[model samples]
Target: MPVDKTSYLLVDGENIDATLGNSILGRRPHPDERPRWDRLLAFTQERWAQPAKGLFFLNASTGLPMAFVQALRALGYVPVPLSGSAEDKVVDIAIQRTLEALGERDDDVMLVSHDGDFLEAITPLMDGQRRVGLIAFEEFRNSGFHDLVRQGMEFFDLEHDTRVFNAPLPRLRIIPIEEFDPQQFL
Candidate 1:
């Protein structure tokens, strides 16, 4: 059966935070960074919404800060409560489940992560004519995962594309790169 032509986006919350925060703070944050959580969720929603099939995943069993999860939901993401392994494993499992359940009905799968660990999770989907894409930041170019990105689907950089900020604009300022500091809000 031909893969479904519809697009489906899978977001890795931790991946997004790692890349985006690095760009904003010049380094990974220390201590609590609650405000950045809001900005990240908003940015993900606006950027992934382009394909109109965004589904964000969070590792609920990890005891993620409650406020951040709520912020993600507020930004239009469907948060699933994950309970096992690392967050990467949780995300990979969720992606696999989605592909299996959809079967031939899924045409494209967009994953927002640069972690090489997910490459295996996405291989089957790519083999089946399912277009798999990545929404990762430029700093993560060292990973071999770039091979998959170059082969199967588009690779969008959060900092490179200002379109997320170019639209009518979100009620909150989550994009534009420069003004996207989440620390002030928290």
Candidate 2:
């Protein structure tokens, strides 16, 4: 089917996992600690006020994580499994190309990652013509995204902004005075 004016939710599973482990948690997350993929799709639809199509990219050079892939499929996401040489960053390269291609299409995109490698592809697409958003943990997002925010690209905190997780994560971010509600801590 022709996906005209469709919102594309491109997920970089590798980047998300790395950042979650290295930056956010400082350890590997348990199965239940991970973001719920279904809620992510639901959140994007409500936030964008448009139906979204999820495209989850994963590197399959070693082998496919069949359970995870099947889970994503059950939730309506297309698992884009790519494989290449051991040295290749298969997922990042594929998503970069996908982002570049989306630049020519009229689709709105919300990319899930904290990797800075995508900045080049994300820049040109930030023009006001279509909605371009970055979804990542706020404190861990690539610094380059600040410039994109100034250029009108929307940035959404995966947990805080999207409320896409089933359980609250152990994240410590500076809460702006006005936006801070005591009830959260209470």
Candidate 3:
């Protein structure tokens, strides 16, 4: 796998946000704070040695904030919104379809997600000529798709690379209880 080849990065936004925000960052899911997209894009481009074309798949029913969507676009990602129905598997389906379409191309393919549902799409891509890999959290080492690693899928753990992906943690301010005035409540 030559690093010079272009890589198409397909991201499952909701799945990643949950893992990064709650599991890694110790923040509530979908908190106002967000990962630094610009830094992440730059890091990936530098590490891979070619500009990665980013496609971010999110659920529309989750009420994606416009500011976030704008931010994604500003950072050079195409936002693909899927319906937010309980039975909706649009995001997974879209990711699979895109992978299949790009598998025929010469560029590399990277799936940025921890969901094992993507294994179906990832398996065939691995057998193809183009290089295929996965970017996920370290927690997924125990996930169902862990076998993909043994099958030669390149896995990049975002947890180990927090400089690029972490959202800013909220600062805590400390005050002496004795100095606190009950009148302040009024």
Q: Could you give the candidate ranking by TM-score, starting with the highest?
A: 2, 3, 1
> Which candidate wins on TM-score?
2
Task: Residues 1-186, candidate 3: write the lDDT tens digits.
Answer: 643568788888777777666765587655445566666666577767787888988777767678878989998998887775788788888898898787677788777788888777778788756667777766643376678777877777654453554554432323369767778458
Off by over 4 Å in 2: 1-4, 183-186
TM-score of each: 0.61, 0.94, 0.75
Clash number for each model? 3, 0, 0
lDDT of each: 0.59, 0.90, 0.72
lDDT of model number 3: 0.72
Model 2: C-alpha RMSD to truth? 2.2
List pairs with backbone clashes in candidate 3: none
Candidate 2 or 1, higher TM-score: 2
lDDT of 2 by residue, 124-155 (tens): 88878899999999898889999898889888
Q: Lowest-lDDT window of 10 residues in candidate 1?
A: 165-174
